[model samples]
Target chain A: MSDSRPVFFVSDHTGITAELIGKSLLSQFPGQAFTFVSLPFIDSQEKAEIAVRRIEAERARSHLRPLVISTLAEPELRHLIAQTDSLFLDIFPCFLQALETELGCPATPALGLAHGMSDAGQYRARMDAVNYALAADDGLATERYGQADLILVGVSRSGKTPTSLYMAMQYGLRVANYPLTPEDLERTELPECLRTYRSKLRGLSLSAERLAQIRAERRPDSRYASLPNCQAELQAAERMLRAAQIPIIETTQRSVEEIAALLKQSLATA
Target chain B: MSDSRPVFFVSDHTGITAELIGKSLLSQFPGQAFTFVSLPFIDSQEKAEIAVRRIEAERARSHLRPLVISTLAEPELRHLIAQTDSLFLDIFPCFLQALETELGCPATPALGLAHGMSDAGQYRARMDAVNYALAADDGLATERYGQADLILVGVSRSGKTPTSLYMAMQYGLRVANYPLTPEDLERTELPECLRTYRSKLRGLSLSAERLAQIRAERRPDSRYASLPNCQAELQAAERMLRAAQIPIIETTQRSVEEIAALLKQSLATA
Candidate 1:
């Protein structure tokens, strides 16, 4: 049964690419249930054989063949892992082979290059973006708003902080987040500090139920976590944002990845 | 020339996975240079047509055919994107089709699900981890160290904060980072607060030159950014970590992604 089968994401590098591609692929198969285990840094022949043994043990225990999705670059190691009694899917070779043919140059594939320090400038930018995101979080560093690529505004726990951090880290964008306090929401205008940077402003909106649920996790039995309070704050925030012509992104069900992607798209167009 | 060819990561979702895979594949061909662009949320026919035209425009301007790497789900949209005059490489359909064949189920693919909120528990864990990392930054919240899945220790700008945030955001690991100042380096033993949770410790080390360069960007022409001081601090930090039997990862030319991967591996083993 699909329920009994497990999935292993094997890679010679971080196993991140393998995991991402595998997750997207498996999400297409919603009817099945599977447990996932990631085995990273399996670069050597010995480690590859050990991975094979682990796959075999898992298969024998579950009485079903497991799915092995790998990003292994070394041919010898990939061969060793592919010999196991499972459905082995190696991602790079087929695509890279086609790319090599098109580009008319053989690829010198190596481990640790996927997420390594290949582009020093981009690497530095990502690190700086993370620091900027931290330093300018929650309206503390509104003075540095001029350097911001985007400023995310929302009520508390509406996902401004996480989305800000994700955009900074993933896209290397200088992102700053400002929380719209109840006092600011009470006013019919946007915060004074955010007015000059209106071009960089984006609003995040969350459903009252989800807001209350998330707030309850942080502060239970408080006025802050009450449903009516959340609803009022959200309504005021949306009203102020729409009046100012700042676009609002509803983030009740979207992940930080989706939010960051939409932000990047908007930044490019703007 | 190879430098003229451009690469486009086209996707219906976040385009993160497509970019990651494309970068790794292109990194193998380091002898060449290429420009990279990501076109996300290309889910509809109109957007797909726009992306194709953009690719075509880039190719025409550069006098070199561009590479289009996509994670599009719908066959119709994929066909539209593939008809572009370039090397079109669609990742998910190939792998997902094979997986569907293996599972004996017809795949019902959809958009916006790759990095979407599929598992609520995981989404919550990732959010909590990001908050934990921020709260515990620079040993600010020592009392909360009890809940940390891992603790990173290093000198200033030795790649502690970014790595901690990345581990939290990517893997949902509650990571705390402690910086060893000169005062702590002058002593022969570890800091009093860190003494109790030595088992959860991991050290990050950077080359003195790299450390100085990074610090100089923050505080120029100061003793804190001096190379000699950096060398002394790194030496003392490495010695203390070795004495405490904490594994040190040298991140001279590595990125935060690599550092976090190594930490995850160490955690799995430890």
Candidate 2:
């Protein structure tokens, strides 16, 4: 009976915050199959009511009350969505009310401000960080290595690119990544560029099985995709990283968000 | 007196979900400074107690009740954080209880599952999307034009790169961007490659003044960065896009997050 339950993430803006919060809750219920639908830009009473009707229809079809997670800021619209038959969780209002009490003032309840251009300078800075990440990706731009906030080293397909990009896109960190080639692994020491940036160096490691699986997707049945090859490269790289006293994070079980957060934490304390 | 309030985002994992929800709420209260700190990886009662102590110390330092937003999954850890000196807003417990009531089962309190690699396929898909975005960026690889989920066209420095990268990084969308050079702008029709992929084309425009300001940061005192030159390029690009009937989004006052959300919305309905 726990199959194909409908879940809706509603928001007046991007619905990303709603989705992130809802996913955290939904992930707790692992066995159930949930179909996620995002209803973004629900700023008006009309849109809110329409979302309610859709949820109702979905509930009627599935014989299960759909879970609705929303971050609606407008009071009237929020109230309308809350009255729906779905199991509603409006993320912002209760928190905002508590925040008003703690701060001793009513919140402004600004719509679309969570992920909007309220601060132009921050927006531009994030864009600049993205460009910096792209330009310095895969050790292509060593000239800007001095400006890097993080330098990730790992074998190919060990998740250096996506983690670097995520760190840049999400937290606006200037991240550069270098892939550990066979030559670099044979040296038994860190690369010269990485040595100068030791303060910023972070290593990403993955299990041999996961590395082989990922590499196989890129190049099927090749020597690079062989499990033995993956094991050798990973073991060598990890040993090199440990010998050089560089911190290593295993990326097999962790998501890119988690890796980026750990990187940020290390940077802050380093 | 509404200055420098302390805020803590506590979570059993990376704290991203807590921070997103908290930021959405705090963005409503502008013009007041808030010192935000994240306490991640608090999976144990000891770490949870340490976080409470930190929050209490911050509250004592600021003479203000700190606002704590958390998505802790463990019952005991959630309880420990909730009973802190700060005004607590735990995001998950009430919602999870409601979900359990609706689903007719108790939810599993899995730590660090929200953004973790619980589903390897989706994670790999996201990494593949990031690689695709990088490969096809700025009209570099046209052979894979058919594979793009979005084709963004804009004049130089019109906020295409970051938005494309965001769509790829956040939503796992394969976004490809092309710059509208002056030669293409002078024409009455869209470029041939774009015309083939017109259904996927999304145009981004900016206020000429803002565009000039952004361009000036890269190349000061150049004709390309001059206000008049930017005004001309933007006008021609806008005219060409309009002639081709491509949907346009103004990036002058929109963050990359906003632009990516709008882009995803358009793609969903298109």
Candidate 3:
């Protein structure tokens, strides 16, 4: 049976947790097909009407009601959405109502703080390092490179950006990354911005074949994506990093979480 | 009392579980200043050495032995870490050693792959969405704006990037975002990109004062960071969006997660 169901996640803040929970719940119904979308930070009545209209349109198109999982705190918006034909799972209202009834008092406005904290200074320092590595221009990053707690260097498509951003967001670390261009490989020297902050620098190496495959997706039939070029770059970059005494992490087989954790450990140690 | 301590989190493949266990164990020591670091996917001898050196350095600097919590699968790395001058707590080793004496099998490779598959897709999708959102460029994003599973448009510093990335990472959705710049506001019309993708666009509107506060942090004492300018931009942008029949979400007091959740719900219902 073909199922043309749409699933929507609406939130008043970062919808990440709700999306995860919704997806996990949806997984229980194996073989079910659905199109998923997220509408983040819905706070006004006018926006609520737009969301309601979209649900109405989807219901008319598919001849089946969509499912909405929301965690919005605004009562009027929730009421507006309820008018739609969709099946609604309002996270905040359901949970808060139950909690309020049980406690015999109106639910207190709960401030959703991040689950954990890292040292603010250390986190900022790490972020600075990542920013230095990824900064568009070299001159500005150079003066500030030394302030970074950890800097990541890798060839393009080496999973540097996501890894750096993950470190910054999850750990509140300032992370900077620089893509090692062919010029840098030919010179067999670190980027000038990276030299003074050698102690903070860490190299992210990927398998040459995997690197080529990833690069091929973005820029097909390019010299940079060639197997031989990839191999040469990998070898030269590793040799340069090794000679400079900069630590290296092979990210080809590792997940983002693994790489971030490894980077964190390296930073703490350094 | 200047008490400095190094905190550590060690894990094998299941870092989340290890983090939980380690946090629980670490709670026993109260009133001690510490730094928490996760050491995930430490599968090899070389990687183990990298972790050990970090622990050793932390121990030396703080004059307090570092806390080493591990679920290292390899016996050799377990032995190597044990030799370090720190408080070593190897969860897997302790459990395996105890269980081996009691049970027949060594329990090296535990069974129940069923538990592994439970939330794998959700986790993967979330990670992919996050990566995609971060890598999306303004121009490319504009072209595919209507095809987006969700779209976020906002004034500068209204928390669009983080929210969009969070949605993608947490829900595995293609999220496209466009910033409603000052020029667009003055014209009293949505950008051409947003105009084409009106149906998919969801606005993130923050209080003008709040927007100014956020922008001030990034570019202090600039015209872009002025409260009056932010107020004007927000008003003009909202008016333009309303005239075009687009939806807007106010993000004045909401958290990122909350915003994302609301967005997900809206899309799911839509």
lDDT of each: 0.90, 0.86, 0.66
Clash-forming residue pairs, model 1: none
Query: iRMSD (Å) of candidate 1?
Result: 1.3
Residue-level lDDT tens digits of model 1 in A82-173:
88888899999889898899888999976858787777888889889999999999987999999999999999989998898899888899
Off by over 4 Å in 2: A1-3, A56-62, B1-3
Alpha-carbon TM-score of each model against the true structure: 0.94, 0.94, 0.64
Candidate 1: segments with Cα more than 4 A from true spot: A1-3, B1-3, B56-62
Between candidates 1 and 2, the lDDT winner = 1
Quote the TM-score that chain A achieves in each candidate. 0.95, 0.93, 0.64
Candidate 2 per-residue lDDT over residues A47-73, each given as its tens digit: 888888888889888866788898888
Q: Worst 10-residue stretch by lDDT in candidate 3 chain A?
A: A110-119
Query: Candidate 2 DockQ category?
Result: medium
Which number leads on DockQ? 2
Docking class of 3: incorrect
Give DockQ per model, in order: 0.76, 0.79, 0.09
Task: Give the clashing residue pairs of candidate 2, or none.
Answer: none
On DockQ, the stronger of 2 and 3 is: 2
